[model samples]
Target chain A: MDVLTDEALDLAPCGYFEFTDDGNLVRCNTTLLEQLGFASEELTGRNVETLFTLANRIFYQTHFFPLLKLHGRAEEIFVTLRAKDGSDLPVLINAVRRPAESGFVNVCVAIPVRQRRKYEDEILQAKKVAQKALEENNELITAKEQLEAHRYILDHKLALFKQRNQDLIQLNRVITHDLQEPLRKIMLFVDKLRLDEGIRLSASGEQVIERITKASRLLKDLISGLREFVTFDVTENPPSSVDLNQVVAKARDLVIRETGFGAVDLKMSELPVIEGFGEQLQLLFYHLLSNSVKFRRTDLPTVRVEIRSSIVQDNQFRILKDRYHYVDFVRLVYTDEGQGFDTRYTPGLFQIRKKLDARTEGLGFGLAYCKKIVENHNGSISTESEPGKGTRFIILLPFRQSDQAFI
Target chain B: MNVEMDIIRRSNVKVWGSGSRTLLFAHGFGCDQNMWRFVTPAFENHFRIVTFDYVGCGKSDLTAYHPDRYANLNGYVQDVLEICRTLDLKNVIFVGHSVSSMIGLLASIKEPDRFERLILIGPSPCYINEPPDYVGGFERKDIEELLETMERNYIGWANFLAPVVMNRPDSPHLAEELTESFCSTDPYIAGRFARATFLSDNRRDLPFSRKPTLVMQCSEDLIAPLTVGDYLHRNLPNSRLVVLRATGHCPHLSAPDETIQVMTEYLGTPSLN
Candidate 1:
């Protein structure tokens, strides 16, 4: 056999060692001894398996040894050696079984692979991070699909709600239009009977006819009021800038003419010009003022109107936070010395024809019409009342609202 | 939408020949149904021949190739059984190449009545050597190196490897055609199939097949060496091992005449050509 020189063997790039069949280390090179931080004497008699970590020791016995025995060599196998300082030395090992009389001696070479192992670990960690990101991306896709499905359902329901609302309005128009004909005929016949047959009728019979005629005229007024209320197509009307002070002045003129001027004291505050339908705004003021004067307390029959403006943060209850761009609102408050009802009636106040006081001779559509007008202007109306106390109506109108109305 | 039709479309099954008895030929790892082109022509006059591509290879439906479903060999065996059930074929002579050999054995073991015989060409029960008793002829490192080789020369590997693996380097045109076919396969599917083929160990499953199996081995095959053929013959109960004088892994491509001769003799059919 050709012999390798001592310098050639010692200066090699890798560590070399020879072990018996039982894994006892017989001899090791200077590079291996240096890598292990050990003296040659300390490692010579030790079991080579003891130099490895517990797991690597088992791997060496089970996989590495069997491979070497079967193929006469094992290449590029991974193992970790226990160093003198209790740290681990990761390496790639190649071993060859040598021929012997009784058994075989194994010659093994190990190359330090700490840098390679670190790169491999980084690759594995990068793989794990990539997998996590993929899973999260899948979850996000699923969530987006669910949101799309919910939006579809909401859009369908909104369409149905709009259809139902249109149908109800159409039905009201038909009923009101049809009721006017019979009312006109009844009034005409009663007038004819009083004019053409007055002498033949008894006085009690004539009095009964007069009462019937009066009730029919009242019914005709109520039907016309409801028809006018439903006919306001606020959604279709384009808005123009109107001064609330002018609107209030117009409403006050109507109230004075109806109540014989100077019947109730009406106070007005400085009001700003806002974008709204002029006719609706005028009718809104007319309804509130009429209610105040009609239900005024006998002792103190005055109504005060105050107007103010401020910014308001959006909330879920009254308005949708995302639907509007304008945050500023104008508040018009009306406080009157009227016979107020219980606060429990506040919810029913805005409902159509819901009267609070039975003694007050009203069709009870005034406040409800006021609420509809306020809503058309992209505003809200609310009331605060206490039994035996006065009533205060607060109307909140957006300062510079654009026409992105939601139904 | 019919399930049987779906299986037929997924496998790209092609049926030909006149005889009532069916010869279902399943292709192996690297190539597709085109690998049986030279050998099937001889059987066309005698038997009803069936040929198909594995999912993800050749013209089979690429969308139907799910990694989790094709992760193990049993999944492929299920495909073979589905083909049998869908076609309603009886007394089938299942001829499998390379990895498909073991795949066919597994199918016959699960449903013995569906198959009449199993013909395994260049088959290995285990690719890794397990010391004193067995020699599969390739070390684990060699297999790893083979995978790396595939990675490095994947573009030209089909052309380059076919000639070498078939031991016909002189016939470069044959390999060029193979290269075109290999390029047709989806790269991701090919990689997955490669990993499954090399890393699997089916040594313990050899004894489970009750069907009479024929092990055809080549003399100088690198992938499945001679000792593996002997191992298969010994483990299988009613089996025979034939050592062909051909020099490479693919006898059907390299020496088609000899392959046809042996198959016809085994089936007790006189030579027609």
Candidate 2:
């Protein structure tokens, strides 16, 4: 019987690990250990879902393991891992059935997708910016002027050109901003062709306008995304000791010019500053607040932002400070009596990519972006909602230890 | 939004007069304070004249008509008092045309101070038919048909009807070829005026008025029949009933010379002794 030596397994490029069907880590190679940033002794027999956030556990239970059990395999499944210190590590895990004496299905391979994700995400962000700018500019240029038949035809042509320009601009800016080392790959080739060194490919013919347009658009997107990302990122955390009443007023003023809110009632308790990102915390608070304002709930146009802040011990601090500090964080248990969404989407509350509410012409990125911002700040976001009773997001984080935490 | 405009009987009833007596000429429906242009001028050097439209019927702001409020005859009467009260007019030789004549009676009943003498030209008290007892000019069904005609073609009140009522080529005041003659009080006020003139019952209002009324009954009065004038005189206390030697409801327009003569005798000398 031939078997891979431990040395041979250590040299393999992909991460290899074996766990029981119950998600207990049984064994792993050095490559897997290093990929996971752990030694063999530290990882064995640990429940795998514990390493994943609750959402990833659900993903594995729903899709990853079911496929493995049925086809004795699953391929290229993307999931985020909880880092050793509780940060998200996005990865693509593939698994194949292996012979086992026990009821274990297969060994799994995890490929870290950090670089690819950044590239795709940056491209997406750049494309979105260019598209948004084009739309806004077009709208401003043609306010209520739909009577002209020629203008409609021109708008159609411009849309296509705008799309092409988006690609070129995104590629150009992705290379220029140098957010990551590898984003340069997409732009450098386009730049070289612009220098007249290469023969004009059919697609490259429009590269004159297309490439420059694409580059300019990419730069524009990156700048805006960076600004927004920075802005949104700072606001992702759950408010620990936030004066939500003040926050409500602040947020309402922001959207007052956009919508009409005749009245808003806020029922809130004083908040404590827990271990959270403040700006992001305020933003998460503001996003939910503005969302309530934007929808108008035409049936009941008056929006009531009720915050249910409780004095529960901060679980994040309890879990986190078990080893590091003596701080006890505050658990901000707030509810939004807002435009409720379908109950089926409750599963996606903490997911970075789920958007269920399409009630408004929203970016569908508010909640998802809110989740990302929250997670980036080391806070956990969750929600329980029904169709009509309205939606409530529950955020738990280590708060600043003080009576002044809440106002 | 219904309002009662105090008609100021233009203190002089004339800004500048070279006259022995004041010539007060009140306008009929669908006109403003400006309808005394032709007749008042003939009396300008001779006497002082006064005229004005009821609230909704003219250049007055249409925002003044409160529908649920002013839905009767006394409201118009009160409007008349208010005009006198505001103008502080006295010894007014009140000359009212058609509905305005009864409006003058209604006002005189409440306040006899404004009118020295009332000249009712083509006045009708009850507009609807009343089981042989009432001498109303039109039947209830006929009045309803007029209302339906108004409501059905509401804009026509503004276009064709408003122009004709104001100053059309076929009507009086072709001399005043004004353009704003077209843009007028709201169509709503016009409808309310229609209801005020044709729908209200002022039969009992005549006896309450004790002023010496001069009834100028017209032969071809579509709105106010000559018999209606007789009915008013039968009910009124000291009214002098006179069958005007003219045709249509508006004697001041169709037979101005005859109307001026009758108005001159009653208001000019009061009692020429």
lDDT of each residue in B1-273, candidate 2, tens digit only: 122222332211224455645445655554454445445666677665555556565455345544433455545665666667665767676777666777777666544456677777777787676876876756666555444333332322333233332223323344344433432255556556667777877665555565777788876454676677788888887877888766545555435678778766766545321
Best by DockQ: 1
Give the Å shift of residue B83 in candidate 1.
Answer: 1.3
Q: Interface RMSDs of all predictions?
A: 22.2, 42.8
List model 1 lDDT by residue over A101-214, tens digit each. 556677899998889777766665675588669868976896698679769977998999899889868868665776787888899988888888545778998999999998
Error of 1 at A372 (Å): 67
lDDT for model 1 comes to: 0.71
What tens-digit string does per-residue lDDT give for candidate 2 at A1-407?
11236877755887767765545567666665666676566665566655555444434532344334333455556666676666666676777766577644468877777887676566656755886798688766754454375478668878987998787667656644645344355466556666675556576476564766576555545555544543443332344545545654566565564555657666676654455455555567667767666643557757776765533222233231112222333344555556677777677654532556444554444676677756665556777676657667676554453333232
- For all predictions, the C-alpha RMSD in Å is 29.1, 47.3
Model 1, chain B only, scores a TM-score of 0.87
> Model 2, which residues run further than 4 Å from truth?
A1-407, B1-23, B33-35, B156-158, B161-177, B182-184, B268-273
lDDT of each: 0.71, 0.57
Docking class of 1: incorrect
